[model samples]
Target: MISSVYIHIPFCEKICAYCDFCKMFYNEKIVDKYLDELENEVNSLYRGELIKTIYIGGGTPSSLNIKQLERLFEITDKFKRNNFCEFTIECNFSNTTEEKLKLFKEKGINRLSFGLETTSNMQLDFLEREENLENTKETIRLAKKLGFDNINVDLMYALPGEEISDLNKDLEFINSLDIEHVSCYSLIIEEHTKLGINNIENIDSDLDYKMYQTICGFMKDNGFNHYEISNYSKEGYESRHNLVYWNNEEYYGFGLGASAYINNRRVSNTRSISHYLKGSYLLEEEILEKDDLVYYEIMLNLRKSSGIDLEKLYLLYKVRLEYNELVNKGLLVLDNNNLYIPEDKWYISNEIIIRLLEGIVYE
Candidate 1:
């Protein structure tokens, strides 16, 4: 039962310096054509599962005009949703409007995620993104007034020349917003992004780790639960859509450059807009073998603080992983057959996960 769906709108009003996602500048005519293709893609592929969560991410889904948004919602309306469906759309403060919020409410969008990144004007300029603090405050107020209770805002840290003080300021502003969730990310200089092209490098590794610690401490002090590696939310406000990915569950991914996992196969759609517009949706599919499934299960399940259910893994895959070594070394915690990395050691989780996988033994 693939009970979740992710839709990608690959158009943005402006490209950020750090973005490497599949995206292009917004064009009304092209958007209309894209929506038409999206309709075709959804109608052809969806299997009529009762969707519990539907996330419309971007390239800024809120950048669309009213008519285009209406069309987009019309296409999404084809899905069968229950009374508890969590519908989310990513928005930018510069583009989101009260009218659009009203439309989203009417269409059953219960969650709104805004990309604030950072409130620092200098950092915003460096990232080539636009945001007005007053506007952001106003927009959130309006969304709340319009009955939007579940909202998320993103924060970026560890940029070149950024200090702990800068990160604290960003965290303070985000806390002031009184929103439900926050996603903090360290700056990664991807090879193809503007930052990489300009030879801009990331901050020092030690400073980056320190900044991450600051974020965790601040969120915890402010009554937020560090639910995942980069996500914190007020209790019961965790992102259900993202949990599908972390839990290694199957889902439907529609639109250009999207990926999906279904029936033990991983599927990826083409990134080229021309190909996508022409109905050439699929790019590749990899059938997962038993070993691949085990690897994925271990890697994904350990991401949560609750950790893996060891008994369930053994029963399902007939593979018993002995991690007593890691637990003894204090790199992992085993409580009641659940294995997890301590939150303090999450900065080096990748290394721990690698070590655990290296010690895997087949039954």
Candidate 2:
């Protein structure tokens, strides 16, 4: 049964240069209509399975005013949650306030993820994002003071003109925040973004790799577990909502430009807001065959530090993978029926996953 849900709120106060997600400038009237449509979509599709994790991600969910947020919460309250439901909302420090944080706590939100991409003024300007170091510190302090502990902050690296020292400074600042989780991402200049329009280019590959290594080393030394390729967290603080995806489990994705996996089928919602407001929610669907499911399982499971459960894979898909060669080559590790990529080999995990797929054996 699906126990996780991801809701997309595609309204942002300001667009970032590197963001390519489905987003638009925040509008109160349009947001009202969007929430109405969202409630309709959820009521129509959700089976009331007692959701364990609900992630309200955005184009800045915190950008909404207090009344709008209240409406959003009323809509989400329709979902059935257990005693330990983990409700998370993505916030921007520029917009998040003490009042909103209080509302979130009262409404069952247990986690807050802020987009503090960098502490460098130049880097922030290049990204076309605004962040005040003092504000960030204050907001985090307030969240913690308000009894919210499961907090996450993002760190972006590999920007043009960014050096090792800059990256280290950013890492040091984030590590000092006392947050529970950190998600480090390398900047990729997508074709349709502001950066791409200006003919911006990615940093040198070697430099990018070096920056990633620095982040990993810093996070590790700071007592965070590198649970996933780009995510680090305190022990037991891993994102349970995201793990639903990496485990290849079914989930419901609601709102504009969201995707869902359910009943062996993949579903994507329309990115066009006009089309969405006109009551056309679905854009595409892909029905997965046994082979497709197995391929997905292999690809997604290998992303975790715990890796793939070889025996469980066999029991579920009847597909026996031959990875002795990879193990001998030191590309994969086999232990207790779990096959995983070593942390050291995670940098080339995609290539390793491709090679493993090439050697798949059907039982």
How accurate locally is residue 276 in candidate 1, as Cα lDDT from 0 to 100? 95
Tens-place lDDT digits, model 2, residues 120-159:
8878888998566679999999999999999999998999
> What TM-score against the true fold does each predicted structure earn?
0.99, 0.99
Number of backbone collisions per candidate, in order?
A: 0, 0
Candidate 1 is scored at a TM of: 0.99
Model 2 residue 198 lDDT score: 94
CA lDDT for candidate 2: 0.93
Show the colliding residue pairs in model 1: none
Off by over 4 Å in 1: none
